[model samples]
Target: MSTKASRAAARLMISPSVILLLGWMLIPLGMTLYFSVLRFNLLMPGDNPFVGFENYRYFLTDPGFTAAIWNTLALVLGVLVITIFGGILLALLLDQPMFGQGIVRILVIAPFFVMPTVSALVWKNMFLNPVNGLFAHLFTALGLQPYDFLSQAPLASIIGIVAWQWLPFATLILLTALQSLDSEQLEAAEMDGATPLSRFWYIMLPHLARAITVVILIQTIFLLSVFAEILVTTNGGPGYASTNLTYLIYVQSLLQYDVGMGSAGGVVAIILANIVAIFLMRMIGKNLEA
Candidate 1:
């Protein structure tokens, strides 16, 4: 077929999927946008009147909103720091020719496949529980009092749980990147009297920079919306201590039955998420160019 004819045929074949995808995305977004302006509450449903920016104002001015924003940022940053650093260390170890390498790698990445809710539940009841948890047992055996993780440090506990789930993903990515590193350069560095730390600092770490950025970008996107772990563990409780934007929206909409406020929060979250994504994308672009 001629080039123009082929191009036309390709467009014809892909048009349906493109239209469907657009509709799928745009429809809910349109509804959310529509609802965000109305004072629609489950308690008072009759004659929903339009209230332009009122919902946004209320949602933004909410006392929990600031705390939620801080918690969301802390959660994302804490998880990213842990996952990236831990992943790098784990990746280095996994890259070594160790016994049962394949099985070990599988075990390392196994946590990623586990459901977030399941992991949170395990962490909450089996490990962090102050009464009968493994940690409690260990503490008692060691003649120490068991620490209440979720209750005493809700945000930190959530961060640790989320970090555990994402660590494997970062490890897998960093390991793949590590595998592609030029070993000859490392050998040359060793021959040149380079120390292990020096080699890592000057060669390995630099080589893994792109993969690290990818991990951060991808993980940050999902980390912003981390809800399952929080819900299963803290329920955004201890007074919004672990309440990220997603959980805040859930409370506004489902718990409080304030659809308008929830929709407004959702919109704000989308804006903040896009802002972060765009910034990361630009950074990735710069890294790629480098």
Candidate 2:
């Protein structure tokens, strides 16, 4: 068979999967777009009239909308900052020859495998609880007051929880990148009496730029949709203090039963996410080219 015939045969084999994937994604999106332009509410069963942009107007004007957007951006940036810095420090430490190195790396990477809901629940009841929790116990031992993390500082607490979960992923990626670095370059720099900080700043960090960019791009996508952790912990509580965009959409759709408004919010979120993704893609493309 000619190369063209072989290519055609391969395309035919994969066409079913391509169609299935497209239908799976496009069908729900189409329905969401359809519902977003209507006055649909689960509470009101009858007279689901098309209201055009009314749903979008109401959703955008809602008070919670602004807070949710800010909270979403804060949560994403907070987690990214913590994970990148902490991951680099942990990666450098782990890359050094030490006793029980394998065990240490495994333990460090273990949290990334945990379910978000489970981790949030554990942190809520075990660590961040104001009473009878580990932090409370530690505080009492130190003659200080236990901090009411979820109640007083819900957003920050959520950021900490998310950062902890994602740190392992960043560390793993950075560690892989670090492991692939040329050892001779580092040895030569050290032989020339380059300080440790100088070596890291000049040699190591530049090598990990592409991996860091990759971690940011991938993590930002998932971080924008963070819901299970907030739902399990704060439920976007403390008066919308911890309500990220995803949780706000959930409240409108499921809790409030405002399906049209929720659908409109979903569309807005998709647009914002696409914008961020495009920006990150361009950044990564430039980094790759460099």
Candidate 3:
């Protein structure tokens, strides 16, 4: 076959999947951009005016937007810290040769398979409930007032739930990376009188840097759009305490019936996602180059 014909055949084979993926991605985005330029309210289905950047201005100036941004940042950072540290510790522990290690590893990974809604519901009612929850029971036994977790510590509650779900993922990634480290390198470090801390810091951490970056990049993408846990637990309440950009956009589009503002928020979210993606690509590219 000629080179041109081979290329044509390859393109024909890939065209269906490429077109499908492109349609899935672009349809919603195109709709968002379209709605963003028009003053369309779901409740009032009538002649909508073309508003240009007015919706953007409204979304930007809204106080809720700032709060959502702050909450989103805090949630992402908090989850990252917990998952990274806890994952490393758990990975180290699991790497040991011990009895029933396989069972323990399965147990460790089980939480990641739990649905977000189920996890959130279990946490809110069975654990964090002020009235009939485990914490309430403990407080009652100790003669203390039951704490309202979702009401008072909504962000922390959401973070805890999200971290619990993500911990296994981070651990698995880091553990895989750990298992790939050169045993000879570790032996040499020990021979050089390197302490455990020094070996971990200089040898292990440096070796795992790429894996860590991958985990961070992937986690950040999911963490930025965390929604189901927050929806089930707090519903972005206690006056927008746990509201992130995703929830804020949800409220704008669904609850408020303001399509224009919601689309503007969607645009902002896309920009933020792209910024994070660019940074992650740069970081990974630099690591690959090194």
Candidate 4:
């Protein structure tokens, strides 16, 4: 077939799936937008009257909304800081030759595969339980207090758990990038008496710059919407200590049975999420260009 004919045939083969995906996404969005302007509540089923931007006004004026925003930013920043620094150290360590290297790498990358709910449950029960958890036992043995992670430090604990889960992915990406670095340059630097710190700062870190930025951009997208961990662990308890925007939206939509308000929150979340995504995409594009 001619090139134009083949192009047309390729488009024909892909159009259905593309159209289906668009419909799937746009239909729910349209419904959400429609509902967001109404006064609908599942609990008080009556006339679902049109109330333009009233839902948005209520949702935005909510006291929890502000806290949720801060918590979301803190959570994302905490995870990014931990994962970027920790992943870099791990990548550097794993890059070195050692016995059982393959096994170590496997173990390092294993946490990324565990489901978020499962990992959060494990952290809550096995590690962070104040009574019979591993940390409690260790604290008791050391003659110290058994700290309650979920209660006392809900947001930080979630950050730690999330960072642990994402570290493997960051490590894998950075390791791949590190592996591509030219060895001869390092050898020359070493012969010229470059210290380890100097070698890492001057040679290695610059090489991993693009990979680090990529990891940050990708991880931020998912981290902002983190819910399962907060739900499973703290339930955003202690009065919104761990409640991010995602959890707040869930509470409004399901728990409160206020579909209109929930839809408003959803619309706000979509706007904020899109803004962040667009900013990150621009950064990624600039990095790629560089």
Candidate 5:
């Protein structure tokens, strides 16, 4: 076959799948954009009138919108901080020649496989419960007051739960990166009288920098849309305490049945996610060049 004919055949073979995927993504987005510009209420089957930008204006001015924005930022930052630091530390520890190392590695990575809902429920009811939880028992034993995590600090509680689920993933990534480091370089540094701290600071950290950035970027994407954990545990409150953008949109669309407002919020979320994706792509591109 000629080169052009082969290329044409390949394109024809792939076109159907590509077109299907595009439709799946673009069709809903188009509907959301259409809905965002209209004044449609689920409660009142009105003679629907298109009110351009009115839904966007209302969504922007709502008090919950501001709180949700802050909560989303806080959630992303909290997860990044907790998971990156904890993962790096655990990865370093597990890299050592410890007994039953394979078993320990499996156990360490097990939490990442858990369902978000299950993790949230376990944290909220079993671990963070004020009365019957392990923390409560420990508090009683220590002659201290029992602390209610969800009621007292819902955002922090959700952050902790999400962090627990993501930590294993970050650890495994960093650990794999660490394992691929050049051992001869480390030995040479040690021969030159580099202290353990100096070796890690000057060598290991630099080697793992790309991996760390990758963990941050990937986790940020997942963390931005954190819904299941919040829904299962805090339900976005004691009063907007844990209501990130995703949950805010869910409440608008499903609970309030305000499709127009929810679509506006959804557009805002897409913009935010795109901003993060741009930054992440730049970071990954730079890493690849290095």
Candidate 6:
């Protein structure tokens, strides 16, 4: 077929999928927007009355909203910090030639494949239970009191859990980027009397800048929606201590049966996510250009 005809045929074939994808995305967004303006409480089985931006107002003004926003930010930043640093160290170690390198790399990356809920449960029950858990046992052996991680330190515990899950991903990405670095530069720098730290600070870090930006951008996107871990571990409790925006929305919609308020929260989350995404995209773009 002619080039134009072939292009037309390709478009025709893909149009259905494109339309379906649009519908799948736009339809729920439209519904959420529609509901966000009303007083649609599931418990109040009656005529749903439109209340303009009342739902948004209520959702925003709620005291938990502030705490949730802060917690969400903390979780994202904490996880990012841990994963990036831990991943860099791991990547550096994994890049070195060693016995059983393949198996070691596989083990390092294994956590990323585990389901979030499963990992959370494992951490909650096996590691952080405080009673008969691994940490508890270790503390007892060390002549210290067992710490209630999820209770006394709910937010931090969740951060640790999330960081553990994401560390492997960061390591894999950084390792790939590290491997691509020309080793000759490092050798040359070493021969020129550059210290190990100096070489890493100047050569290795600059090479990983793009990959690091990519990791942050992608991780921040998903980290904003973290829910299962909180649900499985703290349930956003000790009373909103670990409640990120996602859990707060879940509380409004499912627990309180206020669909409108939940939808408003969802919209708010989308806006925040988009803002962060745009900022990260620009940052990554600049990094790539450099």
lDDT of 5: 0.93
Clashing pairs in 3: none
Q: What tens digits encode model 1's per-residue C-alpha lDDT throughout 1-290?
A: 47998999999999999999999989999999999999999988698899999999999999999999999999999999999999999999999987999999999999999999999999999999999899999999999999999999999998998899999999999999999999999999999999999999999999998899888889989999999999889999899899999999999999999989999999999998998799788987887887
Candidate 2 backbone collisions, by pair: none
Score candidate 4 by TM-score against the native.
Answer: 0.95
lDDT of each: 0.94, 0.96, 0.94, 0.95, 0.93, 0.96
Of models 4 and 5, which has the larger TM-score? 5
Candidate 4 local lDDT, 59-169, one digit each (tens) = 999989988999999999999999999999999999999999999999999999999999999999999999989999999999999999899999999999999999999
lDDT of 5 by residue, 26-110 (tens): 9999999999998877987986589999999999999899999999999999989999999989999999998999999999999
Cand. 2 TM to true fold:
0.95
TM-score against truth, every candidate: 0.95, 0.95, 0.94, 0.95, 0.95, 0.95
Give per-residue CA lDDT, model 6, range 1-290, as digits (tens).
47998999999999999999999999999999999999899999988999999999999999899999999999999999999999999999999899999999999999999999999999999999999789999999999999999999999999999999999999999999999999999999999999999999999999999899889989999999999999989989999899999999999999999999999999999999998899788986786899
Clashes of each: 0, 0, 0, 0, 0, 0
Residue ranges of candidate 3 with Cα displaced over 4 Å? 1-3, 282-290
Q: What would the TM-score be for candidate 1 when compared with the true structure? A: 0.95
Deviation in Å, model 3, residue 279 alpha carbon:
2.8
Candidate 1: pairs in clash: none
Stretches of candidate 6 exceeding 4 Å from the true structure: 280-290
Tell me how candidate 1 scores on lDDT.
Answer: 0.94
The residue ranges of model 1 lying beyond 4 angstroms of the native Cα positions read: 280-290
Q: Cα RMSDs of all predictions?
A: 2.0, 2.0, 2.0, 1.9, 1.8, 2.1
